[model samples]
Target: MKREKVKHMSVKGGASLFALRIFVTCLAAAAWWECLFSVFPGMVVSRSWLYGAGLVLAVIIGGAVSCPRRKVAVPAVILAAALLCWRFFYVIQGAAAHLVNAYLAVHQERGFEVRFWEEGSLSAGTLAVGTAVLVCVPLLTILLLVIRWGRGKLVAVLILLLPVLAAILEGAFPSAWATWMLIVTGGCYLTAAGAGGRDMAGPAGAAWAGTAIAAVTLLVLGGVSVLAGRAADVIRLEEDGFYSQTRQAIQTGVVDNLNAVRLRMEGQDEEADDRPEEEEQLPREREEDRAEVAAKEAPSASDEQSETPGDSGAGTLPWDTEADGMTDLASVARFSPDGTAAVDVRLEEAPYGTVYYPLRWGGAYTGQSWEETSGEDGRDSLFLSWPEGLDRLEELCASWPSDTVEEAEKQIDRELTQKAVYDTEPGRTPTGEDFAEYFVFESERGFCVHFATAAVLMYRMMGYPARYVEGYAVPASAFSRQADGTYLAVADGTMGHAWCETFEDGEWTVREHTPASDGSASPGSETQTASDSALRHGQAGDQEKAGPGAMRIAGRAALLLAIVGCVIGAFFLQAAVRRKRRLRVLGGRNRTKAVEAIYGTIYDRSRTMGMKESSPLREETCRRMADMWDSIKEQEMRWLYQLVLESMFNEKRPSAREYRKAMDIYRKTGAEMYSRLRGWQRWKYKYIWCL
Candidate 1:
């Protein structure tokens, strides 16, 4: 009886430890996501909070399912960890090598630069050796470890990781391979952990208890999946995922800088109060100056003094004395769209597109309004307009001395090279030098942003209404082939290219410059098939194409589908892949510690986003809803806080319904708060939150 009691106590202790570990890891993960969401407004918009939460939950579910508590589980875990570590070592080495080589070879031609690397400073030939040793060796070692040392389902984990590693390596692209490898590794282990399995006390009771446990788990998992889907939607609705805030900050800085310069030029010393009646002040100044100069000069002195104006508004400011057409550039907008065509111009560390925020013009240029422009059918194209007054463009086009397209292209190549690339180094930073000199000095190696900005300003110098446009530059694959040789484009994620659009002839047209002139094909050039010419006309088809609004809907839908698909697919795939392998449960002196570590990690990550207690008083909720706080809404935060509190403190876990409700409110609160802040302020809030 005493022995039986001791065994019961041991089981309880193990369960308690397991629960504690899971709780701590989840808690840490929740806190991390909460801080991240609050700090990066884009993160909130992108639904990163829920995305992360879901990922952590997946890990917990995986670990719980894989509960290896027998004698052989130890070596299986160690082998898996070792294999993963070796894989990490190889991937890192490759990335580091690429970065170093790219850093060194910045000036090489695209061809000569040698994009791919195999091993340490060597060419592709050495790759085979490394691959054989690093990949094949570890894979073989893992299989051997499982077959020899592992006794149960742990053998299946090795099988799952093998094909995933192969897929990652086959990808060719370093970035793609590295990232996908990480995702695959995470998925594989989660599966081998028996993510789909149920628990039973022992072989004798396994059948009955497993059946009960399995039923409960399925219900619990299904419910979690539903709640997760809702949470993902909430996040997607809020996050912009990129530089919306940064662009706003830069634009504000530009405006403030320009305003300061204007203010300084206007000099407050010459206020209206300082000006006496012109005749009266002139005569009084003349009499006083005449008396004073009587002792020092003749008529010649008075004539000279009258010719020049002093700080008292008699003399021009140095800024005014500069040549005409030399002033700083002006802001230009879409002439057609009242304020509809604006996009965000702020700089950001992360990539955000123009859809969520509109860019604002800060300079002095103006253009034709929407009413002045006409579309193909003699109507306005949806919000499409451009800067007007293109005499400068006419002169540029006319002066090239070559009327043929080929000659024009060649001349453009030469001029742009001299104007952009000659005498420049590859990756040097730009500074406050002559604008043209700065471009050439900086070696024109910068991205489209620099090229487009410089070109726009140069156009403005020649008196043209030129504004920058930011949008997706879809690659050829986005389109479908038709009967003719032309292509029809569709919107896809790969369309994340940047280029400038100029308004001319009552339509916004693509502006071709260096890239095309240099003989590189545009994104859509090669994909055209001879019989696909009809697809070109597809551009003019009756399709009422989705605009920014439609694209947004598509993006959200894709994100949602991706979230659901990844979770479900990963779970099932993991289970199927591991079903054939025998299970190995952990034992030995250090087994408990390993389990503790793993459980601890899981708990911390899960609770990263803190839950709250009961809904709070309205007044307290109002007071707590600071703009920078991480919750969805000020008032709703009280609800979330209550839920989190209950989840942490209450002995009984809250129903899935309660969790879902809290998550929904949290997202709504964030969106509402965002709507209230200016772009700059929003960015500032994100920044502080991140910090």
Candidate 2:
């Protein structure tokens, strides 16, 4: 009875130790995330409360799922952590890297110029969720694993150092809280090591102890953080002494190394990315061979010089011609769609013979709107991949609109089109950055204006002189022969459309590349395939078709069943894999680790075979299993219990002879366990759960 009481107390202490570590680790991770949230505010939507909520959610998830007692597979925990914080991994790293570069660049003045401004950053809400899942969730999981079963104290210290150092490197002050968290975590871990899983009595008591520790830590650390932020200079540790000199040197070295590491991570060297912006560049530098070839083939800036209005606007694009254009590019003009023709086109064989006539030019692209900048010097094409997933489209139709015109500027082009005209699109708000950003990145369904706006922006980004032109399309088949041997196309208000024109190779070309309005591929759309068209068109027809509807339902049902069956199959498969791994250890090297399998196999086989309690480690369970056999093997049962104890409490591994004896009992115990059970229970214990 005394031995049983001792074992019970031991289990409680172990649980308490694990629970304590988990709580402290979560606190450390949340504090780190909070610091990161401050430094990189753009991680989520621009709201402190939202990021706070996200941090809370991540901490809770990390603690609950990663508790050592859960015994979750390492790979599964990693996958779950990744899935939880997938959004942050996708955007935060890149954005934060850029923001760091920008911050450093502002200080450097001439090193590592980037295009972060041109490329829009993340929405605040997305950032909040991603950082929580990516950083906090993973931090908790890693720390828990490190504290519970990791190699050494040094590993845990190194892991804890990352966030504290990152916050410091990012130049975020008031980072005392994170630093304190790290210091406290290290101290707690050391204390835990000294105690050796003893001081606390039960899991519940451990939790209360952890909460009290965390609260005291927060009170002290939170005060320090606030004080540091409010009066950093007042409490500055600077004096004319050896200590001060050494501290400054260490600080400088650390910062330089961190920067070097960051540059390497971003795939850049010290002298890299300092080239001409107009030159061709790849989105990723991992393809070093390709990037070098591009650099070699790129034309120098002096090759073709274009006239620039000294201060017309700081940007080369239409909106860049004015400060407001950078913010208000393409605010859609509002009007009720009462069949109004935005522009009429009349031409012999469609001037460019591609899409529509572009009359008005939206030049320098500022942010808010297109600022028309006057240049007319040289046609430029970067001929490169766009950074923000915008492929530089070569819509240069080999004929300049200026070259075709003789007397009038745009009036003659508008008067010379003979064909169908598309109508002005329905007025709707296109928010964020500008109409082009909304159209290109966000809008899946929008009006013709969106298509045209995005096209013009892509062309400008390609380094070609392009303009957003609202004009009527000329579908050749819609035109009829007039009495004068000429085709007469009606400029219907319903046929109004928009397109883009650009100067390439000394000629003006138009590209009326817009997605089809019907949401399926029109005959001439360059973007979609027949399969996509069939899938999209099938959406409505599946509901309408009686025969196909039944098949669709059946297919869906089958898919659901397959998914459910696969989930159940996976659970069984994982159990089998774990058991197989344990069995190998039972007979393999490292008999110490294998000893648990000796008890585990017997425990599992005896579970539902008249055993009432679930725990297999109990002495009562050992006696019950011993009772099942016809001939009592009391001596072997006592030895089996002793082996379990040695595996847990003793440092030394079980000898080969000891393990062999356990295995023999393991087999006999299983047979005796099966003989006592009813058929179904035996099958369940022997195969399903036992296996």
Candidate 3:
């Protein structure tokens, strides 16, 4: 009964040892993948197959040396330690960077998609933390191996449980890599246990246990691989979906709101023009007339009508020319049909080249009846004010030649326009007395009109001849192909826009101040505009093609295969080395040495077959052998034991016949030992080298 229990323990120990070997090999493979990819990201993409091959080679090497031999084990451990140190200090940062980039790519916020390599995406502090975590992976792996190799099963089990504890703590700060690391660490622990090679009671039981453990591990790993493949697919779908939706929203939202504002402004302008000529008097004249009218009407009017200020009639709207001082200011301009079309014209045509688009250039802000110029250049020049807070703009353009109007315009469009587009929120109207001041300093929100008005005023203050022009500006991207093969630009009320026009060489050049959906300033030149459109279209095409998705799937598949191949290869290599060692022991230099080797092998084999405590081998060898076998085998075992004792203690060489008989006994006992094992154990013994 005691012998049977020992055999069972031996089988269980063999399983553990096999599990440990596979775990170690997988850990090594993962470490190698991280190191290679991080250190050579560009090369990794093309030479990924080479990396996989290298991983297999590393595992084989690890297994060949991780045996009971002192010479091999000592050197392997030293080399492994050195490599771990090198990776921790030098390679960890790049690995961390790679992980960070992957995480951000999958989980970016809506409407703020940014490239991983873009500036400001990764910080020094984040890299530092990531490196530390990467280093910990190898450190933990080494600790697991040491505990397993030292036969500390309890400590080894505790080490395996670390990942579980980490998982419980992961909720505080969730990270995808943390879960992956836990899985990897857990696998490593199992592999380490199996690699120890001490728990098995006999070769048959050990082989059985190792085979069972390996099969289960492979199944679990396969499941994980399938899930990983699915995850890649999901990430790809999400990225494409979000990018398309966000792009569409930006296009529709900005275009629609700008058009609505433009139509409202045009309607108000038309209403103002239809008012009576008598009502369009100068500021002082209107004030005098209003006071006179009020005096006459006050006595006859109701108390409510009289009490209300600026009430031309009982049903006047609040926004009418009564309560607010804003109506007196020119907020909208009229445009001819051709002039409106010019706003949608391609930049190469010089849309503002010859047309004299009128703008509310020169105006004075009084409490009522705001003053306006006669729409002449001289009058417009007279009303242009260089506000006190414009030293910055002046300094920015100071380096330009006095006549470098084009260059100055380009500089302003590029710098200030981009700032307003990215920094400001659209649709926020200015409310302060100084529109330019409020738009630039206090308010961060506005549409085309607000951005254009501020830009025009800023240019004027900087001594540039700039004016605000309100018209329809259609992006070339919004153009439809006509039957004649010419592009016909489309503009609705939503396409109505306000932009700045700077005078240079006797003509006003259009300068767009609005930003596009991608947060870039509207292209300033024809070439730039076309390039921007093409780039956007190309990006859309790329997303539709799903190149990233394919790459992700391929990459994950390669990683999974590499890990599995390395582990299986390691197991085979270790088995081969053990077989070679056994053969060498059996074929010694002399007869006495051969007999001594045979006795030592048989004694060890007997102890492994039964879980008996250590005792003097010379005294208990025959007794232990008798206990392990049945009565029929005991007589033959005793004769074999006597022959081994004579050859070792008497320092005598056995005869050829005696040597042959001893060899026959060893083979027969080994076969009997295997046949006695359970059916599953006998089957497993044929494959795994637990002996």
Measured by TM-score, the strongest candidate is: 2
Model 1 whole-model lDDT (C-alpha atoms): 0.33
What are the runs in model 1 whose C-alpha is more than 4 Å off?
1-123, 127-182, 189-449, 453-499, 502-506, 509-544, 547-691
- Once fitted onto the true fold, the runs of candidate 3 whose alpha carbons sit more than 4 angstroms away are 1-403, 422-433, 477-490, 518-691
User: What would the TM-score be for candidate 1 when compared with the true structure?
Assistant: 0.26
Q: How should the candidates be ordered by lDDT, best one leading?
A: 2, 3, 1
lDDT of each residue in 1-691, candidate 2, tens digit only: 5346434644565555555665566556555555554444433334464446554654454455445544455556566656744644556574455445544533222223455443246666655554455444555555655554423557667776665565456433324444665566555553333222211121333234434543554455445444343222211211233433454455357644675587789888754456554221111111233222222333333423211112222112211122433223344532122222222222332111122322234555444455543344324332211224233122322222434322122322232111111223323445444455544433322455555555565545444555654433434333322233333333233344455555655644454455443321111221111111101111122323434335434444554555555565465456445544554555567777666776776665555544565567777777887775543376778787888887888776788788777765664454445445575664354336643
Poorest 10 consecutive residues by lDDT, candidate 2? 529-538
lDDT of 3 by residue, 1-691 (tens): 6446545644555445544454454553444334323322221122343334334443444444445584776576567656865765444546455655644532332224667743233344444333434543344445434533534545555554443443233211223453444445444444434333332213434433544455555555655676565444333233335533454455357643564576587786575457453222201112233222222222222235222211223222111122432232223212111111111111212121111112222343231223333332422573355455545445655654535655555665665543443332332233334544444544434455555556666566557766554433433333322233332232222333445666655544565565543221222232111121201111222333555556456556656775776687577557645744654455444666666666666665576577475553555657776666542256666776777777767877788777666665554455456757677665444445334
lDDT of every model, 2 decimals:
0.33, 0.44, 0.43
Ranking by TM-score: 2, 3, 1
lDDT (Cα, 0-100) at 109 in candidate 2: 24
lDDT by residue for model 1 over 592-612, one digit each (tens)? Answer: 332222222222222222323
Candidate 2 similarity to native, TM-score: 0.29
